[model samples]
Target: MELSRRGFMKAAGAGVAATSLGAMGFGGAEAAVIAHVRPMKLASTTETRNTCTYCSVACGIIMYSKGDVRKGERAELVHVEGDADHPTNLGTLCPKGAALKDFVRAETRLRQPMHRRPGSDRFEPISWDAALDRIARLMKDDRDANFLASNADGVPVNRWATTGMLAASATTNETAWATFKVAKTLGIVGFDNQARV
Candidate 1:
């Protein structure tokens, strides 16, 4: 009558399996019911390859999108995971990369430009054109005011000290290079990238 640990585990497993099978109604008549169950949600989804944008690591990701776009339904992202074939990450993601879906679907994500006037306590949504115009005006004004054409030693170095540009790490190499060129042309010495930070 004495049961060893191995024997007890086997008996417990059998009992649990029996109970689960009973609850699932896996008998002859109910076997058909279980066969009619739907497949996994991501099984039929379309997959796209992408890279994580949080940092410079650029971990590859497989993004799953559902819905038929031809039927006036836009494809919605359903799932994301690290790409096993990628040489950089090798099917692994950091915490930030793993939670990228949440970031994309977050309710607090900004959909449009917002402006908070000086001495104002609240930010109001603004049009893209208005935002761009405001930014250009501010930059122009700051550059005109703080632009140093030469140092005290009479060195001809044109530089803008009031403004800096921080580029995103998700940008392609070509795009980043172009951005850097533009920043250098504008005499922005305080330029950096999100990856470095």
Candidate 2:
């Protein structure tokens, strides 16, 4: 096949016209997308790298959001998918991880800490600081009230059996170390991890 200058110019012109139209959202390029799907919502949203909180695997996830929440704006979660560049799951999500979007958007999902007073029928949302302070106070009270200083054999066995600590196993080594140190410092005898369950 012999190509002339006129034919080459015509072909190039057609290609340029099609690409320019597609760039302007004309949807004229129906054959296939170039490199990626340019019109998808996933391309327009802000991508966030996160870890799946469902289990001990700690699969890497990509969360796409629409607005800026740091400036006191309303941010909507648009999509959640496994990150291909991650090392844990390698872009594959389990049954629960696959439906993480639904989990996040579920009506019953707890967005804040809720507390129900003694004999109260329902729970009410509270500030994060208040919740943390309440928990710390309760734990301190429990430890002070029921801490065992010594055993029957006159051995110094400092233990707090009434309160327990459950740590997430998916945390990093440093976090796990810190958690263990904190629990041991608190004299917590009933320390467990989520992976064991």
Candidate 3:
């Protein structure tokens, strides 16, 4: 056999190219490598069952948390996923439910009541008690000013036209019923539920 320089060069180039391509993952070897790399963060966490609060569907969720409260360290939420045993979700989650973990852990989430005074450009954090007091005072004033005792036909009627209550869809039926009763007692005629909207 005659060894030509051109043939030798071609063979060497092909060998180098094959080696480089294999190293750069031209084949499916990268997938195998990634498949073996499992996350260890959830290994020692505790799992709890919860319900999604975004809407009325009330999808079940499995919440994973770290540490144990009995051991002195507070448990922190680490992950959230649809609960397989839940009757509503059945191990599947909508886009919002799937991102519930991010929402719960988001840095921008409001932790306290905020109030922006008229003509103020920014919202100022307010205590929950102060916020509730202000809300009750304003609602009472509105109700007193707008309460109608009688119509033009001289019929006895009690209704407040200025105040409206929009109930959350995530509330349970009992809660909704209680809210409705409260609205009726307060003479609030303008009421709606978020689920209907």
Candidate 4:
């Protein structure tokens, strides 16, 4: 779009000539070349509001998807972009948020929990129940083993130092509060959040 003075004059002269030709009934070719633009893919997709989960900024996002899931159809995500009306980010996204499509479509992306046994060379996907049970068993064992009831000074203290808990950054305020309460109730002393990092 950067037009120098000479380029501008040339463009203007061409415009004049083209208009003069059109006025003389030589406009068929021009009409064919300037046909109406077709509606884009976005116009055919559905829009849904969401929040970016890469961090705690809670940037609003608009998700575009094709296919309706209401009638036994699977919905496929087509695109994602910042929500201009959102107050947090104002239509801007960080590199991670902008590349969420790549994350969603990545070949190595994990859609389920994966577990690898000791000495095993490969990891295998496991059911959500199995994963949760294993995690709870391990955490219970660690807490029972390392939880300190009191310090050397004999002051009462109930703290578990062997395990840590990290909450996702994309949670709502109520979820975060509940997570914090659960961590505290479990005597977790190393609780943190990915967003804070």
Per-candidate Cα lDDT values, in order, are 0.89, 0.89, 0.89, 0.89
Worst 10 residues of 2 by lDDT: 28-37
Measured over all alpha carbons after superposition, the RMSD of each candidate to the real structure, in angstroms, is: 9.1, 7.3, 11.6, 8.8
Q: Following a full C-alpha superposition, what root-mean-square deviation does model 3 have from the true structure?
A: 11.6
Best by TM-score: 2
Per-residue error for 100 in candidate 1, Å, reads: 1.1
Clashing pairs in 2: none
Candidate 2 wrong stretches, greater than 4 Å: 1-40
TM-score of each: 0.69, 0.76, 0.70, 0.72
lDDT of 3 by residue, 97-173 (tens): 99988998889999899999999999999999999999999999998888998999989789898899998876567
Q: lDDT by residue for model 2 over 1-197, one digit each (tens)?
A: 98899999999999999888878767745445554656775776788988898899989999999888887878788888899998888999999988988888899999899999899999999999999999999999999999999999999999999999999987777999999999998899999999888
Window of ten residues with lowest summed lDDT in model 4: 30-39
Off by over 4 Å in 1: 1-44, 68-75, 152-154
**Global CA lDDT computed for model 1:** 0.89
Query: For model 2, what is the error of residue 136's alpha carbon versus the real structure, in angstroms, after optimal superposition?
Result: 1.0
